[model samples]
Target: MYTNWDDLRLFLAVAREETLSGAGKVLRLDPATVGRRMQRLEAALQATLFAKSPQGYSLTDAGAALLSRAETAERAMRSAIAELPDTTDRLTGQIRIGAPDGSANYLLPQVCAAISDDNPDLDIQIVALPRVFNLSRREADMAIAVSAPTAGRLVVQKITEYHLHLAASEAYLAAHPPIQSASDLKHHRLVGYIPDMIFDRELDYLGDLGITRVPLASNSVSVQINWIRQGGGVGVAHDFSIPAMPGVRRILIDQISLTRAFYLIRHTDDQRNPRLSRFAQALSTGLRAEVARLEGLA
Candidate 1:
């Protein structure tokens, strides 16, 4: 059986994307062309690589075996390319980052903007979701996680420690009974993540306060913050996000405060790539500074 790096590259893309159309978007090819190449590659290897269905193409047992080797080859290719002569000083290509909504909305915009301004050739994509990203599936090049992952072939770096506090809009505070203690929270409408949608224990801010009911709940931190901004209800608000909400103020700061660390996670195999190493260093440094600067204002 004979195959080439190009075929393996296509296989990796399809495996990660789980659809010909998605792989085509990555490779800048039409779906029909991508499908033809996949067929040719499967014939060359004389193995069934994918199981197609209405949902998408899923890797077969043989394809799963090939995936590990293909990833190793991909990393090797990246390393080789990095060693080649430098034609340009600026970094080029697209890097996608997966992060929870809070950091994605309040933090990454300014930080990534500065990086993009400096490196005009680089394209940055931020994927903001409520749950953790699957790095092995290539959902993103890197992810910003609220907590450190305990297992995987991964590298986790503590980006920064940020604070959150029980807060409310001035309007909400004035309209409702004053919250002099955590117990006073019972009389007020509470806003928070849906109980079942709390992806991380660190995110169960209201639960830590011994509050079980959320009158207004949303999975997105941005939505939660907006609810507070519109005088919807009081909830845990990140200090970094408070500066963005002009009327919102932290209440019982000394009594109730939560400090959580943001972690930058990457594949262990990516450590060999110089470009990613440089980008990661820049990102970590930027986040630390931005968090401090924003929290100071809050």
Candidate 2:
């Protein structure tokens, strides 16, 4: 039996947000109400959908099995709504954006919030996956890429350039030997990405530092930042992101720095869609302002 669409919406929100309170905030409903509805839905389906823990709610096997179906339902509902002739001029559809972790975590949230505030009906999903996008497969409606596509039917616009520098916690630097130059990095513990999993060559940061191995490594920028904050080691961080983080400070700024560009990319076929074009313009403007902040120009 099909669960009510309303219940499915709640389930999807909880699944995505990973907490009842989080889902409640998104749905504008009370947590108690959300929990009760989830219980009712579980009873109706005779399935335990979630495994609740102190950390957050995670999908049970049954819930995992149902996720794709739920997503299909969501897409169908959105498609049906999008196809309806709009009586109002507002955009009503979802736009999924794929972006590298640094930009996704540090920059896009405010930009997306401002856009969503203006277009209340729009659903924006930021896939903060630092990997190349397959635009032909519609992996993302839009993306912020490190480099422009050399061969693809994709429209690309250079957004802005930003800088990254070696950084570490104050405590870490005090406890460890002084780093006077790039050569000093070898004497300190370093956090960076796993070599084999470096999806984009531009992300091979350690190579730029002339390091062949990291003392601690993960494929996540957030993890690397946390390690640095915890005095795990020194690592490279974007200038824009480190300012928001009080615990970390840049090191050897004169000796080591990297500059990179962000490109706003979209499928060429989508250029004709008014909603897509409008969002692209907003994103580009917002990114430029953010880059200004990164460059200390804002």
Candidate 3:
């Protein structure tokens, strides 16, 4: 009878990772179990496959030759693994992406570049959000969310931390109560995105500040910016977001700095898709860098 495939597979990961612990992470097994499986594979083959080193496990000559064959088998098995991340089977398709207007719209250009770079054939449908897109229902193929954990058991990757500050146009700040401290903002005319537009659960954390949400609500970030610039009100804005805009003025950077996490939520069901995986990685990477750029960290 042929040797079991699982042991060989575990051995391959150990050889590639160069540590039993690292291999266990790839295989989702305990380190001892990985060691036991490697032993079993070696015993079955009656060959010493690895020379364990202080730095890591290195494959002996026999293991090195076997590694190439194992990799081939692994790729073949991946092709047969029921689902793979790459759009290997299907060439062209659309990916529906739902995101918030504030940062998402600003960073869309950069994200488009990454997507175009990697998945030129895959079309991206940008959905504006006031409500969370239900990924379990496939409302969007993926989402850039400021969302909380949901009951559906979805996979959410935190991409970056978006920090908020109380800002106004120079004209607006000049006309409002002295915002030198948190207490002084009590009477400022604050422009804000419609409370409904904030889809993140942590947004409610803003309530802890006791700073009232300005009644002059607009659903669009541009409209809110225009209102603030025209001396309509002081508003909560991302510090990074406003540095590039010509007219917005920060009032209380220290007193108003509140940070929230931005997440990219993907379905656990589609986690194995090569195209989606690549797309997600590129999106996350671009977003992390773009946010740093926006914050002047770049």
Candidate 4:
């Protein structure tokens, strides 16, 4: 049976995006056009590819089986396109990065900005969520994660080790009892991640400190940091982020220090694509230097 590569390409987009509107945006086509194309593709194959619902399009069993084959074909096409002499040396495509809000807010803005400055045509999107990203679904082209995922066809690169320390606004410390040690944290209002919402054990900052109470808690790292900036409470803060918030000071750095590493994750198949390889190299190098520079100020 002969199948159009364009139809297969559209199938991959709809599968990855899980919505005709989203696929439309990516392909620069209207939703109605995308829907019609999907219908035509399904009809030509004489098989239902997606189960439609208000939530969006979900792949049926046959669609799941076809996804791997479609991805293989996609990678082959990318490799062929990369070999063409007409290809530009500069990266010029949209690449979405999924990351925890802390890095997304404090780290990526500068790192990605420098990259974009060098390659003006490159479009970078950062999806800041406080949970793990599903790369298999193509939610992002790459992701920065606190921990390496053990079970996925992924390429994981350790970016750098970053530090965090107990911190509070200078005003809060002046108004509250002096914190001489970890024990003193019990006497103060603590800000941290919501107990039940802690996505990763690495994010359980307060629990590691053996503190049970969090009077001010949020699922977002930015929210927790903002609360600390406003004198809401003492909480663990990223060392790199401290220089940006003037009044926030790290407390008991000698006694209360936490270290974590960031890992750059990409789909295994994408390792063959030269564009992504160059971008990944630039991102990793920039993140290491940026982390060192910022932590020096902290």
Ranking by TM-score: 1, 4, 2, 3
- What TM-score, to 2 decimals, does candidate 2 have? 0.70
Alpha-carbon TM-score of each model against the true structure = 0.93, 0.70, 0.65, 0.92
- Please give, for residues 78-128, the per-residue lDDT of candidate 2 as tens digits: 566545564766666778899988889989998889888988998999989
Q: What is the lDDT of residue 103 in candidate 4?
A: 95
For candidate 3, lDDT tens digit of each residue in 79-174? 465263443633356677888776656776667666676656767777776667777534577887776566774888889887777777776666
In angstroms, what RMSD does candidate 1 have relative to the true structure? 1.8
Scored against the true structure, residue 90 in model 2 reaches a CA lDDT of: 67
List of clashing residue pairs for candidate 4: none
Between candidates 2 and 4, name the one with more favorable TM-score: 4
- Per-residue lDDT of model 4, residues 77-155, tens digit only: 8678655564677889788999999999999999999999999999999999999998876778899999999999899
Give candidate 1's error at residue 265 in angstroms: 0.6
Report the lDDT tens digits of candidate 1 across residue range 1-298.
3449998999999999999999998788999999999999888888999999999999999999999889988888877876777676677898889999999999998999999998999999999999999898778889999999999989999999999998899999999898998888888888899999999998999888888889999999999999999999899999999999989999999899999999999987777767777788889999999999999999
Q: State the displacement of the C-alpha of residue 75, model 1, in Å, after optimal TM-score superposition.
A: 2.6
Alpha-carbon local distance difference test for all models: 0.91, 0.84, 0.72, 0.91
